[model samples]
Target: MTLNPNLRLRRAARIIVLDPEGRALMFRYDVPGRPPFWVTAGGECEPGESFDAAARRELLEETGIIADPGEEIARLTPEFITVEGEPVQADERFYLVRVSEARIDTSRHTALEQRLMTQHRWFTRAELADWPEAVFPESIVTMIEQQERAR
Candidate 1:
């Protein structure tokens, strides 16, 4: 495969957090000049951090819930622009994290997340597929279904 040397590679972890009632938690990112988009709770792995640990940490920072990242269910490599505007190829591992109830608190968000993330909501698979705003990964519905069904 031809490699793009200019692309910055990074390790990241994302969680598809499901509430007890089966809705997934999502955050709306309102970046300036761009349309709003929704994404699961996650972020880049800190230097030398493992995917699972990063998943747990990012979950707590983004949702204020401390829970085990249920399982490593899916993986994807997606190219996107970082919050800092740098182009990156993210080696992302997706985990399924189920909670007993739907809860969210953004007080602990990092400055970048706090500034770009304007709202949080719970959505069903159908909503995710048809939401007015775009969802990251673009294939989240199918990926979630495949992993969820395997459970």
Candidate 2:
């Protein structure tokens, strides 16, 4: 994707939240004018907030999961247009968070997210590899494998 010249630079704290069975939790976005895509849980950091803090906050806000966001597993600098139609240069950090359950609550999502983010699903490694739709931070399967190896 072409980076918008006027794009705002932002920092994001995302999570590769996995269930005990190794499936990662993902949300699907059905943007009005774009093909649907999946994304891990996360959002931009609040001003002066640390990435670690943002990870924890975003996990709770987006999925209603109150858990410690484990070590930072990977990082990416991706430029994209936000659901709000704004362009952003996202400095993203992916953290690892393991959970025993896959239940999620979207009640706390922002208005834009509530409308455009349609549903959530738990994707196995195979599905992540060929889900047909784009999945952000595309290195997820690698990250999950590495996390499993380290455990």
Model 2's number of clashes is 0
lDDT of 2 at 6: 70
C-alpha lDDT values of all predictions: 0.87, 0.90
Q: Which ten residues in a row have the lowest lDDT in candidate 2?
A: 1-10
* Cα TM-score per model: 0.93, 0.93
Best by TM-score: 1
The top-ranked prediction according to lDDT is: 2
Cα lDDT tens digits for candidate 2, 1-151: 4444577888999998898888999999999899999999999999999999999999999999999997788888888898878878888989999898878888999898888889999999999999899998788898889988998
Candidate 2, TM-score vs. the true structure?
0.93
Deviation of model 2 at 22, angstroms: 0.7
| Model 1: residue 82 alpha-carbon error in angstroms | 1.1
Clashing pairs in 2: none
